[model samples]
Target chain A: MHTLDVALGERSYPIHIGRGLLDDPAPILARLKTPRVALVTNDRVGPLYLERVQHGLERAGVRCTAVVLPDGEAHKDWPTLNLVFDALLGARCERSTTLIALGGGVVGDMAGFAAATYQRGMPFMQMPTTLLSQVDSSVGGKTAINHPLGKNMIGAFYQPRLVIADTATLDTLPDRELKAGVAEVIKYGLIRDAAFFAWLEDNLERILARDPDVLAQAIERSCRNKAEVVAADETERGERALLNLGHTFGHAIETGLGYGEWLHGEAVAAGTVMAARLSRDLGWLGEGDLDRLVALFERAGLPVQGPKLGAERYLELMAHDKKVEDGRLRLVLLDGIGASRVSDAAAPERIAAAIEACCA
Target chain B: MHTLDVALGERSYPIHIGRGLLDDPAPILARLKTPRVALVTNDRVGPLYLERVQHGLERAGVRCTAVVLPDGEAHKDWPTLNLVFDALLGARCERSTTLIALGGGVVGDMAGFAAATYQRGMPFMQMPTTLLSQVDSSVGGKTAINHPLGKNMIGAFYQPRLVIADTATLDTLPDRELKAGVAEVIKYGLIRDAAFFAWLEDNLERILARDPDVLAQAIERSCRNKAEVVAADETERGERALLNLGHTFGHAIETGLGYGEWLHGEAVAAGTVMAARLSRDLGWLGEGDLDRLVALFERAGLPVQGPKLGAERYLELMAHDKKVEDGRLRLVLLDGIGASRVSDAAAPERIAAAIEACCA
Candidate 1:
């Protein structure tokens, strides 16, 4: 077992990573402020892990109720998010009731948000069951439900009491989701962890093969990087904006294609390639470096090419992203393999060129 | 103008109170982050003051787009909140765009919640047009929408950049609404300031008559007390809970009678009487103190009697309140005429007695 702390002053919390950590569950159980807890999961992941988690909590003398939402990115909307609220309120769950998010990103985001807003707020913990969530979304306090017009357009930065990334849960995860998780894992390295980037390059094969130690290390390092960034800037005020490296482009793709049409990590994977390509166009990144970055995403089974959305359409959609400031779209682009920073160009032509060049 | 600050460390902001405070618009405009602004108001308050606020922002170089919602507590829900999001997103307002909440409590709560969630959040200013909002809800950062099961069941603890409490706007406020605002003003005194409570007693006629100087002093003092408590406990972790002296009983009345049936301040007025009665029953408050509190509500033309929702029903409803810690109903009972504290009684019998006694 490995533990990392996101040092956010009084808001600091621990992220636990290990295989079969759900079996004992002492740490997670001990964190609950209430004897009764609501476990929010989804149909896809619930069947595989719900009973185990319930038994684990029950073993520790805590009462557990489960709310199983339908699985998919599309479910990250208001109506669906309300199911968790209805289940909790219908049960007459008091403010002290702890919400345990027990699925992937969609469930985590919705449950975290439900915990944030339910009765002004309630205590919650994250038990991420997927690679993508374990390494990125689950570690951060950013929680939201998608708006009809945009992805994750409405949400809050409400932190959880604890985050449990039981890597064994990923044993049941699909290959596509596994690869998508690697996209964010690569992101942490690209943003600020050059050593971890080289480590990922060397251990990509073992990671794909599901070597437990290698995967555990991968999760820990990614979380460490993310935790540090979040701790420094809990609300994405300044340095934290660097974490949205490809999200500006990625959100545009997601919103333009309709939320669930493409997986989030898939869009981000493609988006990162575009950011790298843009960096090259601006002469900040060498052609060889851009090629290597695209090759890395391709090797991870991610899409190197973005969908053929027109540059104007992409630009229009990107403007609605949370990153847009003062009418200019600020994007986190790579200056090199392991360096990223936020930049806004006055010239639109270059952005159009990058969008044109990176698409299928 | 009377400007007081809510000293919440870095999150601190100023509350400006007086006649024609909205007309000048310099301080308010300087607080906005972008040239564009989205003004969220309601039908009732919109036709009365929207044009003035829009003109104010425009005069200061802001492009204001208005999204007027239906008025009243009933509209403080998700669908109404979405209207604000739709207006901003449809217009493609960037993240830096500021949301100006230009109405009473309902508008301020929903608009503040909108600002907290829109694009993760945007800068927002509060221009509370109603006395209830100006004295209480707008001064603090507690923004929320109602759920069918409870009042303020869904919301966030998000603060505004600046609060413009234009006492002059109250000139157009309905008599009932103006009296409702006094309930919260009275709350400030009941919880912390005996001097303010005595001042309210001495100047009830002047306040009811809408004497600008007296009302401004009341608003400033009320805001100062609220700002101090909020600064000490921004998230209602400790001392802040004392501010909700009558809120538990008050929210029960509001939720029990249906959201819009009784004005929030009216319910709070009756609730405060109930709290005083409970304090007397508990031997913490003298009979004279209770009489003084009830008489103050009477002079303000606020309801001193709660609707007969039944004791058991009130208990059941309050159990779902944000204050319920591990199933114990925490009530803020008055220690005397000007002192209050949070206490979780083991028995609900006294609360039941108070509810039964205070009801019409």
Candidate 2:
């Protein structure tokens, strides 16, 4: 088992990564303020692992109320979020009742947001059950729901008390979703960690084959990189924006196609490609660097091209992105394979050409 | 002009109370990150002050987009909140766009919550037009929307960049609304400021008559007391709960009567009486203390008796309050006229009896 702490002062929490970690109640019990919790999951993950997690906590004398939401990113909206609130209020859950999110990114994001706003705020924990969530969403305190204009347009930077990334859950993740998760794993490398990028390149095949050791190593490294960045810039006033490397473009793809059409990781993979192209055009990245970034994503079975949403449409959708400041679009573009910068200086024409060039 | 800073470290902000603070743009301009703003107001307050506030900002070269919502607490819900978001997204408002809430508590709360969630967070300012808002909601970072099940069930503790409490605006406030605002003004004194409570006793008629100096003094004192509490306990962990001395019961009254039926302050006024009764029953307050508290509320033209909602219903509604912990109903009850503490030790029957005694 590996544990990484996100240092956010009083808001700081730990990320525990290992196999079958969910089978234990001690780690989660240590962080809870009370013995009662509202376990928020989805129909898919709920049927598979809800009882196991619930029974474990119940046996340990913790009261658990299960709220099973419909699975998918499309359901990550206001109406869906209200369902969590409805169930919580129905059960008379209080501010001290710990809220445990027990699914992937969508579930974690929605549940975390519910915790952030439920009675002003409540204690929350995450038991991520997907590779994308385990490596990415599990570490960052960014919790939000999708809006018609943009993805994560409405949310909060609320940290969890604990994050348990039980690697065994990945065994049931669909092949496509697992590859999608790799997209974010690669993001850490492109944004800040060069050595981790190289390591991922060397172990891409094994990671794809569900090699526990390799996968665990990737999750740990990704979390470590994320925790450091979050600790330094909790509110994204500076270096933290680098984490959104492909997110601005990725959000456009997600919104442009309508959420749930493309998995978040898949859109992010394609968005990273577009960002790489833009970085190359800006002379920030060498042609070879772009090739290597693309090759790793391609090798991981992730999308290397965005859907055929025209450059103009993509630009329109991207304009609504949270990254836009004072009417200027600020994008996280790679300066090199292991370096990135948030730049609003990219010309619209260059961004458009990059978008056009990367589209299917 | 009187200014009180709610010391919240980095999130600290100034509350400007005066006769015509809204007429000048300098104070607001000093805190704005950008000259662009989305002014959220209700139809009632908008027709009177929106153009004046907008014109003032426009004269200073600030671009303002006005979103007029239906007036009243009935509209302080998710659907009303979405209107603010729709206008923001429609205007392509970015994270830097300052959201100025230009009305009473409902506008301030919904707008503040929108600012807290819009684009993950945006700069927010409060231009509170009601006396109640000026003294209470304007200082605390508590922003929220009412749920059908409970008041402020969904919300955030988002502070504002600046708060402009224009006493001039209160000149146009309705008699009932002005009395409503007085309920909160009296709260600060009852909780921690016995002197302020005595001042209200001496000059209650002058404040109700809209004497500019008396109103300004009342607003300043109320804000000062609120700022001190909020700065010390931002998220209401301990001391801050005392600030909600009447809010849990008040929220029950509001929810029981259907929101907006009894203005928030009116409900709070009656709720405070109930809390005083509960305190007396608990041997925390003498009988004379309860009578004095009731007399002040009555003199202020506020409801001293709650609506005849059955005690069982009030208890049921209060169970869902944010103050509830681990299924135990924790309440802010008075130890005396000027001191209060949150306690769950009051027997359920005692609480029910208090509610029954206080209701008309």
Candidate 3:
């Protein structure tokens, strides 16, 4: 098992990524404050790994209260989140009773948010079972639920006590979902690590083939990159905005098309291309460099073109981005390969051109 | 005007307490990040103060999108909180658009919570009109709404950009509501300031009579005490818990009796008496001191005895307190008159007995 720690001082937590970490109780038992635990998962993963986790906890003398929510991005909303609250309050889970999120991104996001606000706050751990969560959502502490008007419009930046990413769980993941997860993995490379991008260019087939060693390296490297960035700016005061390379455009796509119409990473995949095109229009990237980036996403079987939403609608939706400051949209854009920065200088017409061109 | 700065590092904000703050645009204008503001108030406080605040901001060239929610604690729930979010998204409010809460504690809390989570987070300021808010809620960053299961069971520790406390608005406050606000004013004195408690004893009539200068002094003193405690312990780790002198019991009372049935400060007033009795039962406080405490609440027109909600129900509700650790309830009992500390050692029978005795 490879462990990477996200150094956020008192809010710091370790992310353990490896195959078969789920079958062990030692790490899970170590971080808990009490013997009682509230395990939050979704139907998809609960049916798959719930018994094993429960058995592991129970074997270590921990009591478990399982709350299984409906699975899918569509269910990531306030009403579904209330289900977690209802179960917790119904079971009389105390503030000290650690919440264990044992599923993919949606479950992890919802559970982390629940822990953040339940009785003001509570301790929580993450056990992400999907590649999307394992590599991105589970490590960042950016827990959120979608609002009717925007994706992840409501949430908190509450960190977990521990994160266990069992790559073994990915063995059961659908190919399409695994491809979508690769989108965010590629994001780490696009934003900061050109070597990793070049590395991805060579190893995309092996990574997608679920080569355990290759996948492990990708996850470890991705988390290491994430940990460093998060350590520098835990609250997105400045540098953290660079990590959201495609999210502004991605969020617009997700919100415009209705949440869950496209998996988050798929929207991000297309959005990254839009950002690349905008960067080119801003004279920041070459056409060849942009093609290389799009080629990588295409090779991973991810979308390179966003949905045909009008430029006006894309701008309208993107304007609602949380990163927008003083009525001007702040978007993360590439300066050169492996270098990115947040800028509000892109002209609306140029951004419109990029969106219209990328959609076609 | 008296200003008390809540020194929470970067999240620090100043609480401006005086008459007619709502009519002056300087304080509000100086703190704004953008020209656009989303002003949130309730039906009750809106007609009385919203126009002046809007006019003040508009005169300073700030655009206003007013969202008026239903009045009272019954409205401090998710449905009403969502109305703030809806108005924000409807107005196309950006992350930099400041949310100005223009009412009492409920408005401040809902708006603050909405600002904390809306678009992930946004800038917000507090315009606290009620005495309860000016003296307590507006100074600290504890923002939340009621859950069916608990009061303040869901919230975030999000600080505001500025706080405008208009003592002039108190002229229109109902006598019962003013008395309820006095309960919290008295709480600060009971927890950490014997001199303030003594002063309250000497000046209760003047305060109840709505003397602006005297009320301003009371508000400033209470905010100074709160600002110190919050600055020392931002997340209720230790020193901050002392500030919750009667809040756990108070929350239980509010939740048990149904929210809005008893105003928060009324519940807190009775809960303070119960904590004093518990302190006496635990041999930590003198019976004479407990009597003096109960007498003070009586003199302030607040409840001295808790309602007979049944001892078991109190225990059950208090068990859900955010302070509970390891399934054991951590309660803030008086260390002596003018001092408090959190302890988990109170025997269940003794706590039940305190509840039983205080109810009668």
Please identify model 1 stretches exceeding 4 Å from their true place.
none
Model 2, B291-330: lDDT tens per residue?
A: 9989999888889889998999999999999888867899
For residues B1-360, what per-residue lDDT tens digits would candidate 1 score against the true structure? Answer: 778888888888988888888778788767767688998889888888888878977877888889999988988999988988899999888778888899999999999999988877788889998888888899779999998898988998998989988888989988999899999998988999999999999999999899989988988898888898889889888999998988889999999989999999998999889888988998899989888888899989999998887999999988878887766888898889778888985369988998999988
Interface Cα RMSD per model, in Å?
Answer: 1.4, 0.8, 1.6
Tell me how candidate 3 scores on lDDT. Answer: 0.89
lDDT, residue B162, candidate 2: 89
Clashing pairs in 3: none
Model 3 lDDT per residue over B103-150, tens place? 888999999999988866788899888889888888888999988998
Score residue A119 of candidate 2 by CA lDDT: 93
Please give the distance, in angstroms, between residue A122's alpha carbon in candidate 3 and its true position after superposition: 1.3
The weakest ten consecutive residues by lDDT in model 2 chain B span B14-23
Error of 1 at B94 (Å): 2.3
Q: Give the Cα-based TM-score of candidate 1 against the true structure.
A: 0.97
- Residues A210-242 of candidate 1 have per-residue lDDT tens digits of 999999999999999999899888888799999
Return the lDDT, model 2, position B7: 97
The DockQ values of the predictions, listed in order, are 0.77, 0.90, 0.73
Q: List the residue pairs that clash in candidate 2.
A: none
